[model samples]
Target: MRMLINVPETVVADGLRGLAAAHPDLTVDVENRVIVRRDAPVAGQVALVSGGGSGHEPLHGGFVGPGMLSAACPGEVFTSPVPDQMARAAAAVDSGAGVLFIVKNYTGDVLNFDMAAELAEDEGVQVAKVLVNDDVAVTDSLYTAGRRGTGATLFVEKIAGAAAAEGQPLERVESIGRQVNENSRSFGVALSACTTPAKGSPTFELPDGELELGIGIHGEPGRERRPMMTSGEIADFAVNAIVEDMPPRNPVLALVNGMGATPLLELYGFNAEVQRALRERGVAVARTLVGNYVTSLDMAGASVTLCQADEELLRLWDAPVKTPALRWGM
Candidate 1:
């Protein structure tokens, strides 16, 4: 596989170094592999910490800033970070209010964050966790026992982080996060597989004129492989899956996310079609975002995420946020 890296093992470390250099408002603990807002431990604010495997750029790491995650502990590419890393990050960011861990439903991530929470609680630091399992793509996967968390992971962080930044209690923040997860659903389709630097090969093989439906962020297999079809048809598949799960007759926040390699022009075209499909189904799209937010490394694909929104969710979502990837209303 063609990649720009000096060594496979150093890929994540090097990328973290680059991220730290690029964003002055963020600080990186290279040794511990933690990314945190430069001015952490905000007095009276509940700290939010969320992370998982690397390669999903602008996710856990790029999301560390004022109104989102206070700290993010990314593991190696497609590998879960250990408990020690999260424990240290929690200690560094926890204010008097406590810390909330917004974890995806992956098994490794769940277990490690659980240990970290216990460790922090032992030190008198209150800890709570909200697990995100919004992917309606599958009920079980190689990496998770239940539904895999996907695009809604971002929704939970943003909405819940806003509440925490507003100095909501830890329990309230956790509750909001859980609500976001409950209200959101996602489905992805992969046109091609991603190649990790270490593996130096595609994670999976997909021939021409075929697509994998309902894929995970780690290049894990989706529900099935099907013959390639028009963008409109693909958009319908995703929109239909989400609509059936949540029946979006109410206002909704929609996301059409590109898996690393999909171009923006294509994403916009797909986004338009997705919006059209939702409208056709009588679903109101109050807010729409299209971009490469959560990704698999070099995978050519896209995913659609829908989060049912009420006035409270809309308010929290509109709150100010200043992060490297998502910055608005600040």
Candidate 2:
């Protein structure tokens, strides 16, 4: 497997340096591994913070900007960031209002963020934490005790960020973030495995001509592997899995996300099938966003995240956001 990097050891730091140079509006601390909006410490606003592992690009880091995350802490590939990193981010971005931590439900992430919240409180910074556990796959997986967090992290951040940016109280922002998580469901399918920088070979052995349904971001074992299915068939399986477990509300915010190596052409085609499947289920989509938002490095696969959005959630979702990976109404 070929990867573009000088070495495996410095991939995270090197990426941070590049991200800093590319987005001057963000305050990237390569040494500390915290990415913050240049104009942080927004007065009277509840600061929004989120993070996870490194493989999911354009996530916690690329999302640091206006109307999104106030700060992000990036850990090594598929590894959770330490508590110190999150505490530093919380302390740096927290103003008089407070800070809200958007944490994915992975065990390491949950434990580290919990400790970080305590550290922030010790530093006299009030903190609220929202745990995103929106994967509709397994109740307990190798990565998490309950449902693993997946694509709903984006929905949680954007909707909650909008609320925070608009001067909503910390309590309100935290409430909305949790609400978004509760209303969203995701299911992923992998066509190929992703290779981390530390390991040149594929992390998991996924035989060719087979697909893993309900795959996790870190390439964890999904529910089952079956012979490859067409785009429409995959869409039906993914969507049916989601709705059968939790039927979404009337209008939804649809996110057809690529797992990294999948091209836009295929993603767009999959998006069509997803929409058709949703229509067949009698689900109305308020807005549809298609692309690689929450990725798992260069894995040839895709995840479908449906967020049941109410009027308020839709308004917040449509708000202006100027992030590196996701930008709209800016």
Native-to-model Cα distance after best TM-score fit, residue 79 in candidate 1, in Å: 0.7
Clash pairs, model 1 backbone: none
In model 1, which runs have C-alpha deviations exceeding 4 angstroms? none
lDDT of each: 0.93, 0.94
| Per-residue lDDT of 231 in model 1 | 90
Error of 2 at 329 (Å): 2.3
TM-score to true structure, per model? 0.99, 0.99
The candidate 2 region of ten consecutive residues with least summed lDDT is: 133-142
Instruction: Provide the global lDDT of candidate 2 against the true structure.
Output: 0.94
Residue-wise C-alpha lDDT for candidate 2, range 159-250, written one tens digit per residue = 99999999999999999999999999999999999999898889798899999999999989899999999999999999999999887679
